[model samples]
Target: MRATFSRKAALLCSAALISATSVMAQDADIDSTNEDFALDEIVLKKSKREIQTETATSVTVVEQDEINDRQASTIAELVDSVPGVTIVNGASPQGSGINIRGFGANGTYGSDQKVLIQVDGASVGSEELYRISTQLFTDPALYKQVSVLRGLGGSFEYGSGAIGGVVLLETKDASDFTGGEVGFRFRQTLQGSTNGNGFASSSILAWQPTENFEVLGNFTYNKQSEQKDGDGNVIGNSAFELPSWAIKARGYFGQDREHSITLSHTDSQVQDRDVPYDSFGTTSDNFGNVDRDIDNSATVLTYNYDSLSSDLINLDVQYSYADQQIDQTYVPGSSPLEGGPSWPFLEPLVNSNHRYETSKFLVKNQMNFLTGGVSHDMRVGVEVSRRERLDASAAPGGTDDRLAVFVVDDIDFGNGLTITPGVRFEDQNIKGNGTYAGDYDNSAWMGGLSARYAFGSGFAVFGSAGYTESMPIIDDLGTPLFMTQSEKARNYELGFSFSNANVFSDADTLQLKATAYKTDIWDITSYSNADTVETKGLELEARYVHSTGFYTDMNANISRGEEFNAGVATDWRNSPADSLRLTLGKRFGETLDMSWEIVANAKMDRSTTPTPSFNAHNLRATYIPQEGAFKDTEFRFGIENLFDQTFTPHLSTRPAPGRTFKVSVAKTF
Candidate 1:
C-alpha cells in the first residue's frame, strides 16, 4: 500500500533518484485507490521512482503490493520475473546466483562477479569457493522497494565494470506503517505452500514516538521439505530452514527537517545437516554430504541534507559493512566418510570456514543550474570499498580495495530534448599474503553519452554509448594463473518508448518501451581461455489498463552472444536464453483483484549440450475490503506452474518446481 511508481520517461531522469510530483511528504491512503498504476510520472511522498511514460531506459521498479501478491518463498522467485534476468543454480540457498543478460558470475570457483547486488546501497556477496554462492540472501518481507536496471550503464556509480547492471533492495521504514505520523502498528502474515510443504510466519512492528523519529523491526521464520519436480522427483539439497530479522530507525533534525539520519541492520541464516555436497544440479554423491551453516548480516548508516530554499545543496553520505560466512564440516555418516572413498575424497577436508566481507563509504551531491541558456542538473559522488575473503579450508584468501569518483549531468535544451553525459575514474588494488603473496593494481576511466527526444505525440527515441573496464582479482583456490591487465568493453543501446491515455476508452491507458543493446568485451578471465566476447539482446515491455479493471502487462527478451579464441568459438555462456511472460488481470471492484500469468523460455545455446526449453502458467488473486470488517485485513491465493511442467531453466540444472498451491493471510492492528 506504500508503493508508487513511474516508468522510464526519458533518458536523463536517473531512476536512482526518482521524483513523483512536486509535493513532498504526503500520506498514503491504504484500502483505497492510492495511485495510478500507469502514471506518466510517479512520486511517493518523497523517495519515489519518477520514470515518466516516455522514459527510454530499461528500469523496472516493484512495489510492496506485487511482492505480497507473489508470495515468493525466496529472493530467487521474487526477482527473475523480469526479462533477460535469470538465476543460476536456484535450487538451494547455497547456490542461487544472479545472471543478467548472460553476464553474471556463478557455478564457478572464483569471485569474478559482473553484476552488482546491494541492499540499502551496501554491496554484498562473494564467491571464491566451488560450492559457495555469489548472491545476497535475505528475507524479502523486509523490503518495500525493488529496482532492477538492466544494461551496462551502471558502471559509473554502481561498480568498476558492472556490465550486467544493478539490483537495489530498499527496506521498509517505520513511516510506511504509520504514514509518518506518531503511532504504533503491528502486522503479521502466515503463508503455506503445497509442493514443497513450505510454511512461513512473518511479523513486523513499527513505532513513531514523535514527528521527528520513526523505527521498524521485522522477523520471519520459514522452512521447507525437499522440493519435487513436476515428475515428483526430489530436488537435490533443495530443503532449508531459515530465520531472518531486520531493524531500522531514522531521526530528523535541522531547520525545516532538511537533514536526517538513518541506521539499519539485518541478519539471516540457514543451517543444513547432511545435505548434498554438489549443491549444483546433480543428485549423485560424487563427493559426499556435509553439514553447512550459512549466515549473512549487514549494517548501514546514512545521512541526508537538502536545502529547502536552494536547489544546489542536496547531499547524502553513507557507511556500510556486510558479511557472508559459510561454515561446513564433514559428516561422520556421509558417503565419503562411510565408504572411505579414494582420490579427492581421501584429501581429508573438514571444518571448512569461509568468510566474505565488504566495507563501503559513499558520498554524493546534486545541484541544478543554467549554462549557456540550457538547464543543467549535475550529480557527483565518491565511493570507497574494501572487499576481503578469508578461507580456512583450502580456498585462497585476499583483499580488494577500490576508490572511485563519478559525475553525471543532465542538460535540457527545451522542446522535450534532454542529453545526459557521465564519467567515472576508478583505481583498484587486490592483494594476497604469505604463500600466495602478490599485488595487482589497475586504474581506468569510463564515460558515456545519452540523448532523448520526445515529440508532442507521446513518442520518444533515445540512444547511448559507453566504455568500461574490469580489474583483476586474487587467484583461485590453488590455481596459479593471474592476470596483469583488466578486461575492457564497449557498450551501445538504442530504444523507443510511447505512452498514451484513452487508447481504448475514456478510462484506459497504454505504455510501451523497447530497447536493443550490444556489448563487446575483450580480456582473459581467471578460468576462461577465450580472448573476446560479444553479446546482443532486445528487450520489450508493454502494458495497458482500463477503468473497468481489465489490464495486461507483457515482457519479452532475446539474448545471443559468443566467446572467441583464435577465431574459433569457445564459450557462449554470456548469452541467456530468450524469455517471455504475459500477465492479464481484472479488478472486481475495490475488494478483489486477480491475475493470470504465462511464462516461457527458449532453449539456451550457451554450451555444446542442448538445454531443453520449457513453459509455465500461474494464477494469483488478492482480496481486501474497503469499508467492511476486513478493511484492515487481506487474503491471497496463488497457483504456480499450473500445468506441472517438469523442465529445468536454461541456467539451472535442477528441475523447476512442480504445481504449487499457495495461500496467505495478513492482518494489521
Candidate 2:
C-alpha cells in the first residue's frame, strides 16, 4: 500500500515554498524599491502560506506579487499550480474555463453550472452554449488577488449550485499606487514570452486628488501567436490579439470614512482568426476553422457602511452587470455537413453567436455578538439576479430571474472548538423565448455544517457535511434531452491541519493540511444514460519557511469517480487524474529571489484510451537592486518546460506547451 502512494510522499519531500514577501516587506522606507511596502511594522507581517493555514476549507490565494512573478500569457497558465483546480482549454482564451473538484466543463461540453466565478463582487462566468466555453476569458493583469474556496462547504454565500467551488478575483485599487495619498502616480509593465512569441503591456494611472476621492485607470495590450508543443508541433487555433482596459473610482464620505462607494468597469476582447470550431479540440472537417470574436465586460458598483460606534451593525450593498459574447464566422467552401438524420432541418451555420448578460444585486450584513456563553459571528444576505441569453445558437434564448437568501453563523466555544453552519434558499424562474417559449419555476433549500477543534499544540481537526440541489438552467430545460428536475448532491469531508511557529528558529514556520472527501450525487443527468455518480478524493498541502529565507511548498490531489446506470458502472467525466505540484525557492535578502517548480500528473487508469503521464519543470527569478539609481526598476525572468517533454495533460485534447523563455520589466514613477 505504501508503494502505491510513495510518489505522493516523495513529492512532498522535494517541494519548496515562495517566501519572499516577508523579506521584501521588511525593508524600511529609506531602503525601499519601486514596489516597496511603506509600512512601519514589518516583522509582524505574514506570508500567503501562513494566512492560508488559518482557514479550514481547501482555500488558496494567489496575490499580486506571485502574479507578477508568473508572467503568464493566459489566465489558465496564471493559476496552474493550485491543487485540485484545473483551468481547461488552454489552447485558446475564448475556450478557456475553470474546473474544480470535477464540477466544471471541458472545451465546451459541460452543462453543469457548479463552479461560480466572481470579479469585484460581480458574477461573470455562467452559460451553456454549443461548442463554446462558458468559463472565464480575461487577462491576469487586471486582478490583484485570486482566491479559491473549494467544495460545497464554503460556497453557500456565493450562490446555489456551486457544488464544485467558488473563485473570487479582486482587481487592483487606486490605493495600490497612490497609497491613499493626495497625488498622482503611474506604473508600467512590459513582458515577452518565447513559446508563443507573445508580448504584453500594462499601464496604470492612479490619482487621489483628495482624501475623499480616488480613481484608477488601467490599459493592457497583449498579443500572442500560435505556440508549439514539446515535439515542436504548432498548436492550431492558439493565436489571439487581445486588448483590455479598466477604470475604477472610490469615494469616501461621512465621518471617520464610515461610508464609501465604488464604481468600476472593465472590458476585454479576444479575436482569433481561422481557429478550429472546437478551439480546445481537433478541428471538425465538416466545419473546419472559423474566425472568432469574443468579448467579456463587466460594470460593478458597491457601497458599504460600517458603523463607527457599533461593531454589530456592518452592511454591504453591491450591484453588478456583466456580459459575455462570442461570435463565430465560418469561412467559404470550408466543408459541407454530411447528410444525417437532422440534415434537412439544419441550415449552414455561416455565422453563429451567443451572448449572456447578467445583472445582480446583493445586500449583506455581519454581526459579532455573544449569546448563551458562545461567541457568535453571524452573516446574513440577500441576492437577486437576472440573466438573459440573447440570440443563442441552437440553445435557449431567455432570461432567468433568481432570488436567494442565506445565513451563516460561526460560533466559537472558547474551548478550542469552532462550528459553522450555513444555509441558503434560492427561488428561480427560467423563461425561454422563441421556439422553446416556456417558463419554469424552481426553488430549494441547501446548506452545510463545518466544525474545527484546535488542540493548542499546533494541531487541529476539521470536518464538513453538506447537501445541495442544483437547479437546471434554460439551456438544460430547452435542450433536446430535457431535464425538468433538479439534481441532488451530498458531500462530506474530513481534514486536519498543523501549524508551528519557530520550528527551527524564531523566524521559521511549518504548516501542513490534509483532507479526504466523498460525494454521492443522485439523479445525475448527462448526455447519455449515465446517472447516480459517486466520487472521492484526497488532498494534501505542506509548506515550510525558514528564517534564512528558504521555503518549500507541495500539494497533492487524487480523485476517482464512477457512474451507475442500469446496474452497470462506468467511468465518469468528472474523474480527473492525480497530480502533484512542488516548488522550492529562496530569497537573497529581498534584492533577488529564485524558485523552481515541478508539476507531475498521473495517467487516467479508467480512460478508454491510453492516457500517459508527464512532468513539467519551470524556473523563475526576480531582481530589484536596492539603494541604487535604478531602484524604481524591477526585472523578472523565467524558463518554462525546461526539458521540452512532449505530452498532453489528462482530459485535454491537445499537447501542452514546449520549453519557453519569459522575461518582464516594470517601473514606477
Candidate 3:
C-alpha cells in the first residue's frame, strides 16, 4: 500500500510540475520579455536593520503570507520547514524542544533552552524549574513575521544564553488591518485537520479612530483529539485544547507622525489530559499519565523616534513583562514492568499535583547613528528576570535578579565592506527564599565580530567569530547547585550569496546561499572546564522564480556534533540527518496558488544503532475570489504525508502523523 501511494504521489507531482512549467514558460515568453525578476528579500535586526545578503550570519525569514499559505497551527511547524533548523514535535499544543545546530536538544529547565525566542522586542519564557517547551506554545496567527538567526547570535542586545541562535517573532499591527484611512476591519477564519480531528477558529478586529491611531485584537481557539500515526494506529496522549488572545494599541505623534508608541498584550493557555511521561527520562519505558495545564501571558510597551529633524540618530525604547506557569496532576495508570522494581510498589501513590511560575521584566534601547565619516548602528539595553517553583518538589521557589548592559556597533567602511562588533556585561544574583538558594554574584562579558563584503549587485561573502559567556539561570542553579561558573561558547562561520536574473531566461531569476560553521561550548551542563561540546554543519539553499509565477526552491543541510575528550569526540549526534527539501509552486491567474513539496532524509548514525531515513510529500492550494461575489473570501486545502510512510524524524522517537487532509476558509471585511 505504501509503495502504491508513493508511486501515485510521484506521478501526480511530476505531471503537475511539467504542466505548470510549460504553461508558465509560454506565458512568460510573451508577457515578461522585458520584466525584472528577483528572489524574495529578507531583512533582520540583530544590532541594526540590514538585508540578509549584507549580514555575516545565516538568517531565515517567514513572512505573514507564508504563514497563511501553510496555515500553520503552531510555531514549530512553521520553523521546522526551514533549512538547518528543527523543532521536535509530539507534544501537543507545546512542542518538545528546539534544536539549532545540534543545541538545546536536551534538558528540562526553560533556562536550558539554547535558542532564544523573542516576540515584538520582548523575550518569552516560562522560567519554571521544569521549563515549558519554547516553541509552539502560542498560536501562530498572532505573529506577522518569524526570523531565525543561525550561528553566532551577533550581539548581546538580545540578552544572554543565545550561544546556539535566536528566533525573532513580530506580532501583527493594527496597520496590518487598517489602511491609511480611519475605519474598522474584521477577519474570521476556520480550519480543520483530519489526522487528529483537530479544529481551530480565529477572529480579528481592528479599529482606527484616526489615521495615526489604531487598536487591534485577536482571539483563537484550538482543539484536537487523539491522533493516528502512519500505520493508522492511535497515538496515545496526543490530545489537547488551547485558547489564545492578543490586543494592541498604537498611536503616532510628532509633526510627521515620525514618533510612535505601541502597547500590546498576549495570553495563551493549554489543557491536556493523559499527557505521557518524558520519553527521554529515567522512566523512558514508563506508561504514566498526567493532566497538564500551562498558561503564558506577556505585555510590551515600545516607543520610537525616527528623528526626521536630524539624520544623526534614531531611537527606540521598549519595556516588557512576561509570565508563565504550569500545573499538572499525575494520574495512576497501568503498572509498568520495565519501570524499575519501585513502579509496582508505588503504583497507588499517584494523583499528586505540582505548580511552577516564572516572570521577567526587561527594558532596552536601540540607537542608530553615524560618527565621523563612518556609519554606526548601536544598541544599549538592560533586563531583569525571576523564576519560582510554586509547589516545591525537589527545589524550592527562588528569585534571581540580574542587571545587564550591552552595546553593539555596525561600522560601514564605504567600500562594499562593513564590520560589526559588540560586547555585553552583566551582574546577576540568586536568592533562595524557599528550599535551596545561596547568595551568589556572577559577572561576565560576551563579545563578537562579523564582517561582510558585497563585491557586486548579486554576490556577497561574509564571515564571523564570537564568544559568549552566559550565566546560569535559576533553574540551572537548582537543588545542590552543582554548577558555579557560567557556560561559555566560541563560534565561527563563513558563507556567501549569489543571485542572477537570467540564470535560465531573461524572465527568470535564481538565488543561492551557503554557509558552514563550528561551535565549541564549555560547561554546557557541567561545572568542569574539561567537558566540551562541539557542533559543526553546512547549509545550502537555492531558489528559482519565473516571471509567469512558477517557482521552485531547494534546501539541504548536514552536520555533526559531539563531546570532546582529550581532543577526541565521542557519542556524536550531529547533523541529525542529511536532509533535503524541494518545493514547486505556481500561481494561476489572480485567484489560485498551488504547491507541492518533497522532503527526503538520509540515514543517520546517531548512536551505536543507526536511524533509518524516509521521504514524505505534501500538497497545498489556495484560492481567492478576485472580483466575484466572494471577492473578500479565501479557501485553502492541503494533504500531508501523502504516502503515509510510517517513519520517525531523526533524533525523535515519536512517530509522525499519517496521511492527513486539512482545509481552511477565511473572510475579511
Candidate 4:
C-alpha cells in the first residue's frame, strides 16, 4: 500500500503538467503581472539605517515569495545557490553552519565564528563547538527578507569579528497583512513533506485597531521522523520537533507622523536525539544515541524620528536582549565496544548544558544636504553590547564588553559617479569570573573607500579596499595565556553590474554581475596568533526572463584558501571547491500559477576530502479559485529529488533524502 501511494503521487505531478498547459492558453489572456519585475534598482541599508545604493558592496537578497516557492525550511537550504557560500554538515538533523570565503569552515572540537547572524537588531548565538547553529533554531517563516553581504569591506557598519561577512534578517510587520487600514486579518497554513513524514502548521493574526496602531502575532509547530536514504536505509537517530512563537507591535505618533516605535519578541526551541560523533565524522560510530535540545529567545525595541523640517534630525535608536542554550544527554547502546577497548567511558547517562546571553544598545543619525552644488549624505552611529556565557560542566565560559562608534559619507559628483568613505573605532574587553578571574583589553581603528561609475551604455563598475580588525569571542578567549592583539585583515574587491530591460523583445529582460576579491588575514585568532590566511575568489551570476514567463538563473564560483607561516604557503584545512548552480523554471499563469523547476549543483577537487556531487529536481503546482467559497485560499503540491539519485555532499557523513513529496494549504480571512 505504501509503494502504491508513492507511485500515485508521482503520476499526479505528471498529470498536472498535462492539464496546466491546456489552461494556460486562456489564463494568459489576463493582464501582465508585476511579480518578480525588480531585476534592477534594489535598495539596502547599513547598520546606521543609511541607504546603500549600487555603489556599495555586493549583497544577495531573498524575499518571502522566493522562499515559499522553494520550500526552504532551513538557512542552509535558503542560501545553497549563492556564490561564495557553502553549508557545512549538509545532512545533519541539528542545523548547519555556513562558510564564507573559508572563514568559518575548519574545526575539530571548537572554532570561532567568522560569519555573523544579525536578527532584527541583535546577534544571538555562540561560536563554540557543541553549540546550536543560530539560524537553524528560528523558524524561517518569521522572516520577511534575508540579506547576505559577501566580504568584510561592506560590513564595517555592524560590530567587529565578521571576517567572513554578515547575514541580516528582517521580520514581518502588522501592516504587511492589514493593508495599512483599520481592520483585522487571520491566516493559517498546513504543510508536510515525505522525506521523514515531516509536518508543520503555522497561524498568524494581525489587528490594526486605529490608523496609527497595529499588532501582529504568529505561532508555529513542526515535527519529523527519521529520514531514509536513496537505498531505503534509515539515517538513525534523526528525529526532531520544534515550537516557535512571535509577537510584534507598532505605534505611530506626532501630528506629522514623524515619530514611530516598534517592539517585538520571538522564541523558538528544537529537540532531537542522535548519535555522538567527533571531527573525523566517525569518532563514535558504535556509540549510543545522543539526545539534545536547543532554545533561543530574543526581544527588540526600536524608536525612529524623521524631522519634518531638517534632515539633521533624522534619528533611530534601538535596544535588544537575546538568550540561547543547548542541552545534550548521551545514552549507551548494545555492542558499544565493537571497535576496541579504547572506549570505556559510555557506562551510564551523561548530561551537559551551556548557555549564551547578550544585551545591545544602538543610536544613529543621518543628514542629507548640499555643499557647493555637490550633494552629501552623512551618517554617525554608536553601539554598545555585553555578552555572557555559562557552562555547568568542565568547559570555558566568560563575559565580554564591546563599544564602537563610526562615521560615513557618500558624496555625489553629479557626473554619474559616487564616492563613499567610512571609518570606525572599537574597544573590546574580556573578563572571567567563577574560580577563573582574568582581564584582557584591545582596541583598533578600521576604514575603507569605495567608488562607482555608471556608463551611458547600461553598465557600471565598482570597487572597494579597506583594513579591518576583530576581537576574539568568549570561547576563543579565557585561556591561561591570554594574548590579545586582535585579528586584522586587508581586503580588496572589484565588480561590475549590467542590466537591460529589452534583451530580445520589448517585454524581455536580462541582468548580470561579476566580482573578484582577495583578502589576507594576519594575527589570526584561531591559530593562536601565529599563522596568516590568504583567500581569493571569483563569482558570476546571471538571470534572463522571457515574456512568456520562462526564466533561467546561473551562479558559479572559484575559490581557494592558503595559510602562510613565515611567508611560506601551508595546506589550509578549509579550502573551498569550485561549485556551480543552475536553475530553470517557468511561471504559467497569474491567478492559478504553476511552476516547474530544476535545481542542480556540481563540484570537483575538494581540498578537505573527496566527495560526489548531487542534483535535485522539483515541481510545484498552485491553484487559486477566482469565484468560489475558496476564493482566497491557496493549494500547492510538489515533489523533491525526482530522480532519487544517491549522492553525498562535501564534508558530509550521511547521504541526502530521495523522492520526497510535499503539499501545503493556506487560507486568509
Candidate 5:
C-alpha cells in the first residue's frame, strides 16, 4: 500500500508541474506586479519584518491568497500542502498533529507538537497548562501570513519546543486602516469506504477605522453528525460515534493603533469511542458520548519607537489564560471483550480540568554600524515571562510555575552575509497536593548560530547549528505513575539556493532552493511504555518558480528513529519514518487559476507500530467571470483522495476519510 501511494504521488506531481508551465507560456508581460503577484513578495511572521527573497533564514511563507486558492479549511490541511511537513489525523480535522524536521508532538493526549505556535509575537498556548489546543486561531481568514521557520534560527528566538521549528501566525492588524472584508464558505466530505458524511462552514470580518487604530473580529461554528458503516454498523469499534463541534473569536486594537492589543477565545466538544484490532480486521464500537471542552483567551500590547535617526526599538507586554475539561462515560459493548455490556451499560466516568495563565514582557532594538569600510545592520532583544498552571480532578489538584529570561543578537555583513546568535535561561518550580506531590527547581540554557553568504546575484549558501531543551510537562512531574524526566535535543543543518532572472526566457525567471538537515534528540519524551529515549533524522525541500505564471514545490524527508528499552515495546504512533508533499500552481489568463497537491507517508513497519502508508491527491480550479456581480467572485471545486485509498496514518486510530469532493464560492467587495 505504501509503495503504491508513493508512485501515484510522483506521477501526479509531474503532471501538475507540466500543466503550470503551459499556463505560464500563454501570459503576456510576465513582469506585471500590480496584479498582486510575485512569489518573492511573500511575507514572513518570524522577524516581524517583510524580507524579500535572499535574506531571511530557512523560511516557508504560505500566503492567504494561496490558501484561499487551495480552499483549505484548517491549519493542518494547509501545512500538509507545503513540502517537508507532516500532519497526522487522529479522528477528525479537529484532532490532528503536525510534525517538522522529524520531531512531532505526542498524540495520545493530542499534546507534543515540537513546533511552537505564536500570533504576532505572543505565545498562543497556556504556560501553566501544557496540553492547550491550537483551535483558538482556526479562522485562517483573519491571518495575513503564516511563516514556518525551520532549523536553528527558529529555536534561538522561539525557545526549546521549537527544536523542529516555529510556526508564527500574524493576523490582520487594525492599523492597516478604515475598511472591512467579510467572507463565508461551506464544505462537505466523504469518509472513503464508510457510510458517513461531514460538513463545515466559516465566516469572518475585519475592519480599520483610521490609521493607527483598527479592529478585527472573527467567528467560526462547525458540527459533524454521527457516522456509521454502509452495513448500518459502527466502524472502528469505536466506543462513541463521530460527532463534534467548535467555536472561536478574536479582536485587535491599537492607538492611531501603533501600540496594539488583541483578545481571542475557542471551545470544542467530541463523543467517546474505542478501537479494537486483531488478525481478523480493525473496528470501532460506539460505547457512549464523551464531552470535551477547551477555552482560551489572551491580551497583548506592543509599542514601537524610533529612538534615534539610525536606531529603532519596540516593547511588548502580554497576558494569556486557558481552561480545558474532559468528561468520559463508558458504554457496556464499548469494550471489545466477548458478550460485552451494551451501549450505556457499564457507566464509568472520568473528569479532568486544567487551567493556565502567563505574563510576559520583551524589548527589541536595532541599529546600523560601519567599520573597515563595511556596513553592518545589528539587532538585540531581551525577554522575561512567568507562567502558572493548575490541574484538578476527583482526587486532588496539581500546580506548576516557571520564569524565564532570554536575549538575542543578529549582525548583517555588507557582503551579503548575516549571522545571528541567541540564548535563554529558565527557572522552573513544581508542587502537588494529590496522590503525587513534590517541589523542585531547575535552570536550563539554550542557544544557536546561523549565517547566510550569497555567492552571486542568484545563488546563496547557508548553514546553522543550535541546541534546545524542553522541561518535563506539568503532568510529567507528578508521581512515579505520572512523572517523567525532562528531554533535550541538539540540531545541525546546511543547504544552498539557486535563482535565475530568466532561466526559461527573457520575460521569465526561475528560482530553485533545497536544504539538507539532521537533528539528534536525547532523553526524548515518550508515553505508554518507555518514559524517555532517543531519535534522529534528515529532511529536504525544493521549489521552482517561473515568472511566466508557473510554480512547482516539492519536499521529501525520511528518518530512522527508535526507543531504547530492552523489554518495553513501542510502535508507529510515536513517529513516522518517511513523509512527502508536492504542489503546483498556475495562472491561466487574467481570470482563471488552477492547482494540484499530493501528500504521502511511509508505513510504520515496527511490530509495536500500527499505521499504514497512504497517499491522496487534490485538484482545484478557480474561475472568475469577467462580467456582472461575479467580477470579483470565484468558484472553487476539488476532489480529495482521488483514488479512494482507505488507510490509517496513525496507529489504530480513525481511518482516513475516503474519496471526498467539495465546492464553494467567495466574493470580495
Candidate 6:
C-alpha cells in the first residue's frame, strides 16, 4: 500500500509541476523581471497577493537586525519577544517546546508542545508535539528575517497544525550574486545558584555570484557543557550533567541561478535524567539518562519568467524533504528497590526515525480590465506530501500520504476595501505497521473570508474567519500506550492598525496595532495526550521609532483557555490564565544601546493539577566600539530572573533556570 501511494504521489506532483511550467512558458508576453514575479510581494495571507496593511490578519515581521540586537538565539527566545507567544525551554536543546495562545495539550505543566514549526515554507515536527527539536534553525547569523502569523487566517497557505499560530523562518539570500559576508559571535553564561558555567562560539559566511544566478550558504556549530546544578541536580544526581550541542548549515540558489534551492541540516544530542513511578515509594539509587538527536534537510526550486508580457499569469514550484531521528535510553542504577530485586528497573532502549517529502505547484494570475475598472487576483495550486516512520521496537511503523488542491480570489471593491475568499480540499491516508495496527482515510475542506478598509495615510482595519484542520501526529495515532484521534479547529479574528510619520514631530513616529481572536478546537492532539480545548485572547503592540537616537516600545497579551473531555468541561491543563510582556529600549549616540524587558506570567492555581507558577524581570545593555576593524563590532550583557526567583515552569517536575548572566560579542565584515 505504501509503495502504491508513493508512485501515485510522485506522478501527481510531476504533473502539477509540468503543467505550471507549461503555463509560464506559453505566456510569452509576461515580464519575468517584474519584481512581483518573484512572489516576494505575496502578502502571505492565504497565499494571496494583498498589501500587508490591507490584510485583516495580524502578522509580525522580525528582521535580522532586531534578532541580533535582542540576542535571541533560539525560536523560543525570539517568540518570547513577540506579544502573544510563550516557550518552555526543554530539559536540554533537544526537548524544547512552544505554547501559543494556550493550545498545548500535553497533560503535564509546561509539558504541552502543540505549536508547529516551519522553515522556508514546509512543516517540521514530530507527530507528537515537543518531541521535535528546533536546534537546526537556532543560529541567528543565518536567517534574514522571521514572520509570525497570529491566527488561522494564514493557515491555509501552510496547511493545518497551525491552530495556535505559525512561525515562518525566512532565510537570507544573496542579492548581487557575487558578494558574501563573514561574521563570528561568542558568548559565556553563568548560573548564579547552580554555579554552572557555559561558553559558546559561532561563525557564519555567505556568498552570492555577481551574475544574475547565485548561491548563498551558512554554517553554525555550538557546544555547551555544564555540571548538574540547581533544579537539574535535584532531578537527576548523575555525575555527568547533561551536555548540549548543535550544528546547522543552509544553502540557497536562484537565475543567474533564477531557480531557488535551499538545504538545511541540524544535529543535536543531550543526556537527560528520567524518574518514573514516583508513587511506588521507590526512589532509585542510580540515575537514568535519555539521549536524543535530530537531523533535517530541505530543498526548494523556483523558476522566474521575465520574457512573458501577459497579465494573466505567474507560476512557482517547490519541493522539500525532511528526515528526523531520535534515540532514548533509561539506565538503571544498582538499587535494590529501584531496578527491582534482579536489576529489572532498566527500561527498553528505543530509537525512532521519520521522513517527510512534499512537492507543490502553484499558479497566480492578475488581470485588469483597463477599460472596465475591474481587476481580479486569483491563485490555483496543488500539493502532495508523504511521511514515513520507523521504530526499533516491534511497534508498527507509520505512513501518511496526503494530496491537496486549492484556489483563492481577491476582488477589489474600490474604496480601499478588498474581499478575499478561498477554499482548499485535502485527502489523507494513514497506515500503521508492526504491533500498532490502524488504517484511516480522512478528507477536509477549509474556507475563509477577509476584508480590509484603509483610512488614507497609514491606517487600516481588517477582520477574518476561517475553518482549519490538523492531523494527529504518528505517535498519537499509532503508539501502543498513548494512541488518540485526529484534531481540527476553527478560528475567528479582527484587528486594526495605525502607522504615521511626523506624529509627534518629524523625528518621532508611532505605530499601533491590536487584535482579538477566538479559537475552538476539537480532538486537540497533545504530545502524548488528547483533549478538546477553547482558546480566546487579545493582543496589543505599539512601536515608536525616532529619527533621534532614542526609541521605546511596549506590547502585551492576555488569553483564557479551557479543556474539555468528550463534551464536558474539565480542568484547564497546562494553560495560563494571563500573561504580559513589555520592552523599553533606547539608542545612545551611535555606539551604545540599552533595553529593559519584563515578562509576567500568571496561572490560576489548579489544585487538580500542579499549575505552572508565575515569574518576571530582565535587563540588558549593548555597546559598539567605534574605529578600526571592530568598527561594527557589538558587545551585549544581560541578567535574567533578576530577583533569583525559584519556580517550576513545567509543573513540579522541571524548575525554571534560576538567575543567570550572559555576555556575548560579535563582529561583522
Q: Highest lDDT: give the candidate number.
A: 2
* Candidates 2 and 3, the one with greater lDDT: 2
Residue range 231-255, candidate 2, lDDT tens digits: 8998766678889899999999998
lDDT of 6 by residue, 1-669 (tens): 122223244446545654766232211111111111211111101100111343566777776556665554445566565666655543334335556676542322222334556666555555442223333324444456777776676656666556767777766654412343333223222221122354445444434333333344444444343333234444222112222222233343432333333343332233334423221112342323334333444444444332245555455555655554544443344224444553342333222233333333333333332335634677667778877777445234677778887777776655567677878887887777766668777788887888777664557787888887775545555442333345677888888877554567644455677888888877655522336777778888776655554556666777766677756775556554466666667666557777777776676564354555466677778788877767766777877667766665532234555566777777655
Q: At residue 363, what lDDT does model 1 achieve?
A: 97
Sorted by TM-score (best first), the order is 2, 1, 3, 4, 6, 5
**All-Cα superposition RMSD per candidate:** 5.9, 7.6, 9.3, 10.1, 9.7, 11.6
- lDDT by residue (tens digit), candidate 3, 1-669: 113223244445545654755343231111011112222221110100112454676888887667887777777777777778865553355545566777655334333556778778666764433323534578888888989887665646776767768888888887897775799999999999998998999999999999989999999998888788899987654577879999999999998998999998988898766665442332443546556677877788888887777754466667777666666666655436436786654442233333434345555555556677777776666666554545345344556677777778788765567888878888777766555556767888888888877664567787888888767655555544433578889989888877545656656656678888898887655322337887788988887777677878788988787777677767554346778988888877657889998989888876544778899999999899888889958899999899988887875546678898999999988
Per-residue C-alpha lDDT of model 4 across residues 1-669, encoded as one tens digit per residue: 112223244446434654655443221110011111222211110110111224447677777666666565566666666778877644333635667777664434323567777788778766566423444567777777778887876577776767778888777788988889999999888999989988888899999999899999999887778788778887644456778889999999996889999998888898765645332234444544557677889899999998898878789899999898877676545336634564444322234567888999989888899898777888889999999888445345788898999888888766657788989899988887665656888888998898877654446788988888877666755554433767788889898876545656656556677888898888776764247988888888777666676667777777877787777876455656667766666655445555555554566454546665566676767676766888868787878777877765554445677778888888888
Residue 474 error for model 6, in Å?
A: 2.9
- Please write out the lDDT profile of model 1 over residues 1-669, one tens digit for every residue: 333342233312423334444323332211111122333333222111223344445677777877888898777676677766887755456567778887775555323566777899889877545655637567788888788877765447677667777788899998999988899989999999998799999999999999999999999998889889999998777788889999999999999999999999988998889876556645356557778888998899999999899899899999999999888887665664455545354334434677889999999899998878787888899999898888454566788889999998888775677788889999988787566767777789988888888765557788888888877765442444444677788889998877655565655656677889998888756337688888899988887666576778888998888888888976576466789988888877656878999998887766765587888999999988777778858899999999998988776756788999999999988
lDDT scores of the candidates, listed in order = 0.75, 0.77, 0.69, 0.69, 0.51, 0.53
Candidate 6, run of 10 with poorest lDDT: 41-50
User: What would you estimate as the lDDT of candidate 2?
Assistant: 0.77
Candidate 2 Cα errors over 4 Å, as ranges: 1-51, 108-111, 336-350, 479-483
Sort by lDDT, top down from the best: 2, 1, 3, 4, 6, 5
- How many pairs of residues collide in each model? 8, 7, 1, 0, 33, 29
Comparing 5 and 6 on TM-score, the stronger one: 6
Give the number of the best model, judged by TM-score.
2
- Model 2: residue 292 alpha-carbon error in angstroms: 2.0
Candidate 5, residue 642: how far the Cα is off, in Å:
1.7
Which residue pairs collide, candidate 3?
561-574
Error of 5 at 527 (Å): 4.5
lDDT of 4 at 641: 74
